[model samples]
Target: MSASPPSPGLAPRPAHDATWRRDAHTIGLVGLAHGTSHFFHLLLPPLFPWLIRDFGFSYAQLGLLVSVFFAVSGVGQALAGFVVDRIGARPVLFAALGCFALAALAGATAQGYGGLALASALAGLGNASFHPVDFTILNKRVSTPRLGHAFSVHGISGNLGWAAAPLFLTGLTHASGSWRIALAGAAAWAVLVIAVLTSQRAAIADRAPGEHGPAHHAAARGEHPLAFLKLPSVWLCFSFFFFSTCALAAIQSFAAPALHTLYALPLEVASLVVSGYMLTGAAGMVVGGFLVARVTRLERIISTALVASALVLLTVGQQWWPATAAGAGTAALVLTALAGLGTGLAGPSRDMLIKQAAPPGATGRVYGTVYSGLDLGFAVSAPLFGALLDHHQPAGVFGGAALALLLGVACAALVGVGVAARRRAA
Candidate 1:
């Protein structure tokens, strides 16, 4: 492939044309769509206890349901990216949202494990395309200077989606006395988002056929279609996502049960830990957005933030809380929150790092391939962490998460070195 650089054929837009209003509108719409996808991530995991109680399923089996979801997603995301590049992002987004609604409905009607597995497969297929679609629109429509803030909002919105899911699902389940009704409610939420986005379709649409101008210059070079596969930075970025998401999978799939076993906290309160972590993480992304604006050494920021998070997880694993009920609960909650804060702080810089690594005119393809690592991490880690919980190794959950973060740190350092080398060579 040819050298990757911003396209020169298209002159930069004027401030008037790239007005704050225009950019903010696009960011807001894309963020909403992104948030909806994330909300679905916890669609079933948040209801795991109910599934276990109602179905008499083992923890590992329930964990495999999540694995099924992400495993399908990991494979589909790469193909979805190429599809987004070929046909346009808007219509694929519409179809994906429709899939979420159908998945939720399917879960509501499920009679056993087979039905639940079908729901999971449908959800995974829907989850596969958001990164490619969202980034394509942002890169194409949003102003260059505001791209940092766009990425920041994107990450913040996703964490907020994570924070919202447990509250929405569990709260509704508690109120209705049925997990099925709560899932039905989720289906309605998906439909509402789809309707709203369809109305504003023009603002967030970009994965269309042909003529992407400067971003599509690679095609003009007559280079092989898969030439992006050769970039070292691309695979390094993939490694970074895979390892980092393993850390996330530990928290998302097993944190509540592990915390409950370790600290004797109520299952309800233990679940709130995920929410607190995500909210604080969102706040960290707010700060990270600013850091990316001022600092160019994005990898250093990622490494520092991740190490801080890992240390906190290690502290949690050590179980240094006071023995009293109040003290122990507070300690577990606060320590988990601190760990989440560190993770959140790294979010924007992580996105920025991937953005820099992406080949020009190949945003959809690169992002699709790189972000698929996220699906693989979740697919693999959920089962491993769930088994740790099953084996009565509750503390291993936290320790394993910390270990994943440290491994991700190594990948990020190497990515930084690789990116620097490429810049010098260029």
Candidate 2:
């Protein structure tokens, strides 16, 4: 059967006039939303030391607070896609921002662990809607040629959010003489962002591919809600997220301590090494954005980048190079940055690959379901690697991380093959 014509409302804008401006606006708004979500993801964690002192909560208790956050986020994320697809992304996006504002307000006023946990849960619920909402809007609004760069900006913004959280939270706390003030400030910032996005609401309105039309209505009525699971590629994409996140969780949680333990590096130097890794990763995302615009072989890009990342991680894990205090620190710093760069380069291509895998008209649900693997990977990594630390095997943490990356490499290859096969069949 011949394919149906493109819906006029969903059609891409002409490339000649004002296209760049529109793309910029769409990307900027979506990127802002994504960054805010990520910023909140790390917001409470960085405040943990202060929370411990202020509330007399044990480390375990505080950790549970974050765990509750991820648990709610994971489950909510999987279900949020359905809502986005059903009602539309714009309202869901607005609601997500509201959740963040409420979460911050809750945290700011909370006097006990129970209140903090409630705030975390609210924040998680807010966080869950972002990926589905952002991606759906981007796929529908951004022109095809620049979609890659749009994804790149989306990713870089999230990294910026993560990078900003500690500085913003810490700086505000210092300035205000109380963490509550910082929390209040964050809540206010959410409201401000919401206002800005609301003003630009036309730019972000849900342009679901066939809104209010027969195709959309058919999809809504005829398709089973869980039909996406029938596709093998969806499961492969989920595995890709799962293992890749496992590798990232290891680096974020343990890379600094691993360096210090392995090389007798000063705490300050170890911290620098970790920071450099993140900065380089962000830089690599910029480069990857350009590469994705030019390269069509996304799977090859993903596989090669992940393989390089895995090898770099393994070299560091094994401590193949001899450890002089200065030399070891330099080696660790360079190697960590290289590893981050490799993964960063793969990120845009990775998102594109998932876009290919998603069944038609189901972008929101597909992303929501697959990205849950990320939260699952994170939740599992802490305890799994924390035990390595408990056993005084810091090197094991990097080793496990390398293993996870290698597994992710395998998953990437499988997904590529599956996608290629499907294309050939079509």
lDDT of 1 by residue, 288-378 (tens): 8899899878889999999999999888877876545576866886788678888888888888888888777788889899999999999
Candidate 2: TM-score?
A: 0.88
TM for every model, in the order presented, reads: 0.94, 0.88
After the best TM-score superposition of candidate 2, give how far the Cα of residue 336 lies from its true spot, in angstroms: 2.1
Highest lDDT against the true fold, candidate: 1
Q: What range of 10 consecutive residues in model 2 has the weakest lDDT sum?
A: 209-218
- Highest-scoring model, TM-score: 1
Compose the digit string of candidate 2's lDDT tens values, residues 161-218. 7667767786788788899999999999899999999999999986544556223664
Whole-model lDDT per candidate: 0.88, 0.81
Q: Which residue runs of candidate 1 sit more than 4 Å off their true CA positions?
A: 1-18, 207-217, 322-326
Residue clash pairs of candidate 2: none
- Which ranges of candidate 2 are over 4 A from the true structure? 1-15, 52-63, 174-177, 208-215, 264-269, 272-275, 322-324
